[model samples]
Target: MPGPLRWLLFAVVLTALPVTAGVLVLGEGEPDTAPPETAAPAYSSTPLGDLDTATVALARAPFCDRIPEEAVAEALDGKVGPTASYDAGQAAELAPGIKDVAHEHGCRIAGPGGTEVRAWVFVPPVTRDRATDLVTEAAGREGCSRATAPAYGDPSVALLCPSGKRTWVSFRGLFGDAWLACSLSAPSRLAEQELLDRTGRWCVAVAQAASVVE
Candidate 1:
């Protein structure tokens, strides 16, 4: 069966697009760990009363589609070609790292010079310290040294290691319970400094929108 996002792609062609404000969707606060994928039992494999609901989506760019093409072009200097915007269900099916934590999300960008970035915001609030430790341990398993990198005023952390000829970098941190993260696989692990800064900017944007963090 075609994926839900694949279906959205097909529909996007047949519809008109809408306008959105910025890169990050602000004002939503966080929340968690999941054991695994488990669907509620089939209820005796029998039919139950069905509930019908209608969904009305305003005419606007998709969450991922809001990633400004020009910004991506300027940042990565590459063609932003065919891309997929995954909805909550789509995120669940496609992004394992995020499906359990975030439902509404966007992809980092992939472009010229063999550069790529991916990001996520966690829900149910993984405290800053816990997020740091969790990300650090994951990075360690990949042979990366984990540490807390500076993010100006915001709390931040990093996981950096060299893999073969390339480098792996993951940057993540939190503001309130809403946490943001980004990973970059670039030519030098040092290049991650830029990514860390970018992720921090996004986090600040979100926090500002919430009006809770200074």
Candidate 2:
């Protein structure tokens, strides 16, 4: 379950309370259908070069800061804001199942105004079905609802959940073998189009920078 402070930090809301029966917990809505197919990334099947564990760990650290300033400006229609990132240790606490992504990475970008945007990354060096399973499990948590958005990669999925004073979007997709999960949130006043754009555009850079294939 997502803690109260985590909800504030991510601007999330709880719509579907968890119904626990034994060890099982289910969300109010079923996971959205698998994301639409897209061009697979090369690294999806190919091995990530000499980028060893230490190197990959360093690359993922401070990932929120990794997205270039220019990319964020373009995503928000030139509305730029300071960005911050967190590793899996912190990312997992932000919400339930965020760490489900392999090599899970995280970031939070202040909305140029009142909204905030966060993105998560998963590297899975596996076939499409394996990637789909990961995506399904990540979004199946309680309080999340499947949403319609451009699939970020092969076998991807997206969802929307409540955020305090905002709407939060959760998107996870398999690009080749890399699975990515991202969330965009903004004050109710912010247009939904902008949030969608942020998730769609920023994810491109994430896909580009991702080094973990499994």
Candidate 3:
């Protein structure tokens, strides 16, 4: 469940956009069909030790500012899973799953904006999923948000850090520019591992989010 404040902001944004009224797909009570592959890629080039400096600066900017660092960390710091770029059918299949998860957790879902997977918001009903076009500042850059488990329960996003457990996830694209990353844990586990494994997973997520054009 996105907070009331977040939901309100989302609603105001949603109203301003043109709504193409139609039914959206929701995932089956079944498991995800994505094959067991490598995790997605991580988009940030800067090291995590130095995240605060760049992130704080970016947070002050228009689109970047909307997201907090904690949220970014959860979404970007994961083990790279499957590597396939979702086709329309796959995206459609996946979109519903994302939505189902969002609704179950109390967030909202929205678009297929850029080039990756269809973008979705897991905020309150009041909050609208503003297109990257609307938030000119957030155009190409990918960002993320976080809510307590009470609000969002578990996130739609998934990351596979080398640690045995799965971390929560959230991500969004900023004004079509550089990407800003924020991961929750210390990098020693995945970051220190061979093959730049964690970074690759983050990239896959970004690529999937960017593919959508909603």
Best model per lDDT: 2
Backbone atom clashes (below 3 Å) for every candidate: 4, 11, 60
Candidate 3 yields a Cα-based lDDT of: 0.29
Question: Which regions of candidate 1 fall more than 4 Å away from where they truly are?
Answer: 1-63, 91-104, 128-139, 152-155, 189-214
**Ranking according to lDDT, highest score first:** 2, 1, 3
Q: For model 1, name the residue pairs that clash.
A: 18-60, 31-123, 31-124, 31-125
lDDT of 1 by residue, 1-214 (tens): 5699899887876563332322233323322355778986531211111201011111211244444444444334357544444443343423324344235454655655556555555434566677667555565564777745544112555666677655656655554555555555555544566644443343333222222322
TM values, all candidates: 0.47, 0.53, 0.22
Please tell me which model should have the higher TM-score, number 2 or number 3.
2
All candidates' lDDT scores? 0.46, 0.56, 0.29
Q: Model 3 over residues 1-214: C-alpha lDDT tens digits?
A: 6699899999987875544222122233457788889986653443222322222212112122222233334333333222222222222233323322222111112212111212232222221233333233322223322221111111112232333332223233232232322223233333333212333343333333323233
Q: Compared to the true structure, candidate 2 yields what TM-score?
A: 0.53
Residue 214, model 1: lDDT of 20
Please give me the total number of clashing residue pairs in predicted model 1.
4
RMSD of each: 27.0, 29.5, 29.5
Model 2 per-residue lDDT tens digits across residues 77-150: 55767765556544344553334322566766775556566676643355787886877786786677776665
